[model samples]
Target: MNQNQSFRQLWISQSIANLGDSFYILAIVTFIYNRTGSAAFAGLFPILRVCAQAISGLAAPLLMDRLRLGTLLWMAEMGQTICFGSMCILYFFLPSQWLIPAVLFLVFAISMLHGWAIPVRNALVPRLVPSHLLVKANSLLATSDQIVLLVGWSLGGILVAEWGVIRVLEITAIMMFFSTLALLFVKDPSANVSAQPESQKRWDRMKEGWITIWGNPILRTLSYMEIISGLGESIWAGSIILVFVKEVLHKGEDWWGFINASNFAGTILGGLLIWKLSKKIENRMLFTMLISSFSIGVLTIAFTYSSNPWFALGVALIMGPPYQARSIAQRTLLQFHTPEVLLPKVFAAFGTILFVTFGFSVLLMGWMADQWGIRFVYMSTAGLYVLSAFLTLMMMKKASRSIQTQKEERYMNKIE
Candidate 1:
C-alpha cells in the first residue's frame, strides 16, 4: 500500500483502539470500586493493573516474535470480550461474594494482554510516516485518545451509575471487539518487518530491547523522564479524587465522578492544542521539555493548596494540556530515532518502567492519604512535580540549544 493509505490506517486504528481502551479502563475502576465500597480495594487496582500489565509488557518482546502484532491485537480483544461476558453474568444474575474477585481477575488479565499490544502498535507508526512527521503522528494519536478518554470517563461514569456496571462492561467489551477488527484494515509497511527468527530466550529478547534503549543517551534520558512523570502523575490520578471528595469538599463519596470528569475535560483541551501544535513544531524533544514544565506548574497549583470545590475543579481542568503535550512529544521522539527492528523491545521496556513507577507512587500516596489525610499527601506531590520540572527542563533546554549549534556547523561545512 501507499504512504497515504498507511498513515490513514494508523490514525483510524489509533482512534478505535484508544476509545476501546478508555472504555475498559473506566469500566474496570468504576465497576470494582462500586461492587465493594472500599477505596483501598479501588486503590488495589493500580497494584493489580500495573503488576499484571508489567509482567505482560516485559514478556512482550519475546511474544512479539511468536505472534504477529495483528494477531496479538485480536487475542487481546477476544480475551476482553470473554472477560466482560463473565462480568455481565456475575453482576446481573449471580450475587455471590466470591464473584467480584473472579471478575476483577478476568478484567485485569485482559488488560495485561492489552498492555502487550501497546508496544507493537507504537512500533508500527514510524514506518508509515516520515521522520519529520513522527511528532505529528504521535500528536494525532494523543488527540484522538484524549477525545475518547474525555467522553469515555464522563459517559462510563454515567453508564455505570445509571444503567449498571455489568451493562457498561458488556458494551465496552463490544467496542473492544470492533476495535480489534479495525486493525485488519491497517496497511503494514515493510519497513517495520523484523528478522524471521527472533532471539533465543525470553531474557535474550528482553535484553536486546533494553540494549537499544541503554545504548542511546537520548532514549535513556527520555525513559527516565517518563518514569518520573509516571510517579508524579500517579499521585494526581490515583489519589486526587479521594483528596477532593474526602478532604477538600467534605462532600459525599460520589463526588469523585465530577472531579474525574473535570480533570478529563482539561485533558481533552490539551490534546486538541497539541494536535495543532504538532504541525508547527519540528523538535519533539524540546517541545516535550516545555510542555512537561508547564504541566508541573499546573499540577502544583491544583494539588498544593485547595479549599473550594469549584476552584479545585478549575485547576483540575487546566492540568490536561501540559500533560498531553509532553506525552505526544515523548512518543514521537521515541518513534523517530529508535530503529524499527528494535522498536517493540524499546517500547515494551518503556511500558514496564512507566507503569511500575506509577503503581509504586499510587501505593505510597494511597497509604499517606489514609494516614495523614489526602491533603498532606497531595501537598508533597505538588512539590515533587515542581522539582522534576526544573531539572528536566534545564537539561532539555541545553540539549535543544546544542542541536541548533550542530545544525549551523553542518551548514557551514557544506558551504566550505
Candidate 2:
C-alpha cells in the first residue's frame, strides 16, 4: 500500500481501537463494581491500568528499537485482544473466589500491551504524511478520536446496560481483532532496526530518548509543559467531575453526563476548526499553543466560579477548542522536532512522564478536593495551566532558535 493508503488504514484502525477501548473500560468498571459492590475496588481499575502502562512505557523503547513500528502496533493490538478474550472466558468460568483477581490481572496485562499503542501511533504519523501535512493529519486524527470518545462512551454504558458486560467485552474483542487486521496493511518505510555500538549497555539504549528530549530545548520545554498540564488536567477525571456536579452545581448524574458530552462536542468542533486552519497555524504552533494554554487556564478558572450548571456547561464547551488546539500543536511540534527514527523512543519517554504525572495527580487532586472542595481542585488546575503558559513564554526564544537550527541542518543536508 502507498503511504496515503497506509495512513488511512492507521486512522481507521486507531479509531476502531479507541471505540473498543471505551466500551472495554466501561464494561470492566461496571462489571467490577457490580461484582464486588465496592467503589474502591472498582476504582482500582484505572489505577492498576495506569501503573501497568507506566511500567510498560518505561520498557517500550527497547522493543521499539528492535521491531518495525507496524509490527509492534499490530502485535500490541493482538495481545490486547487475546487478553480480553481470556478475561471473558475466565469471567464466566472462574470460581467466585478467584474471579476478581483473575479479571484484574487480565486488565493489567491488556493495559501493559496497550502502552505501546499511542506512542507507536504518534511515531508512525510523520512517516506516513509529508511534513507540510503533519498538522492537518494530527488534527484529523484528533477529531476522529474525540468523535470516538463521544460516541463510544455515550453508547458504551447503554450497551453494557442493555446487552450486559460479557457481550460488550465480546464486541470489544471483535473490534480489536479488526483493528489488528487494519494495521497489517501499513508499511513502515523506516522499519530498519537502529544499530547501536555493540559495546553499548542496555541502560544507555533505554535512556537514549530521555537524553534526546532533555538535550533539545524545544522538547525539554514541551516536557515541562506536559508535566504541569498533566497535573492540571487531572481535574477532568470522572470522579472529580462527578463531585463538581453534585457539590458545586447541586446537579444530578445526568448533568455530569451532559457536561462531559458538551466537552466532547466542543472538542470535535475545535478539531474541525483546527483541521481547516492547519496550514495557517503550522508555523505559529508555539504561539498558538501558548495562547490556547492561557485561554484554557482562564476558562477553567471561570468554570470553577459557576454555580449554574448551564453556565458551567458553556465554560466546558468553550474550553474544548483551546484544549484541542493546544493538543494538536504540541503533537505536531513533537513530530516536527524529533527525528523519525527516535520518535518512538521520544514518545515512549514522554508517555512514561504523562502516566506518572497523571497517576500522581489523580490521587493528589482527589485529596485536594476532599480537603478543600471540588472547586478548589479546578482552581488549582487553572493555576498549573497558567504556570505552564509562563514556562512556555520563557522558553519561546530558545524553542524558535532550535527550530531554526533544525531547518538549517535539514537544508544543508539536502544541498549536500
Predicted model with the maximum lDDT: 2
Model 2, TM vs. native: 0.95
CA lDDT, every prediction?
0.71, 0.91
**What is the clash count of model 1?**
1
RMSD of 2: 3.1
Taking the candidates one at a time, how many backbone clashes does each contain?
A: 1, 0
- In model 1, the worst 10-residue window by lDDT is 190-199
Q: Report the lDDT tens digits of candidate 1 across residue range 316-400.
A: 7777677777677778777776877788888989988888888878778778778887777666766666665665676677777
Which number leads on TM-score? 2
- Candidate 2 worst ten-residue window by lDDT: 191-200
Q: What TM-score would each prediction reach against the true structure?
A: 0.84, 0.95
What tens-digit string does per-residue lDDT give for candidate 2 at 1-416?
A: 49999999999999999999999999999999999999999999999999999988888878887788999999999999898889888877889899999999899999999998889999999999998999999999999999999999989989999999999999999999999999999988775556666577778888998999999988998999889878987887888999999999999999999999999999999999999999999988988988999999999989999998999999999999999999899989999989878889999999999999999998999999999988889988898888878877877877678789999999999999
lDDT of 1: 0.71
lDDT of 2 at 133: 92
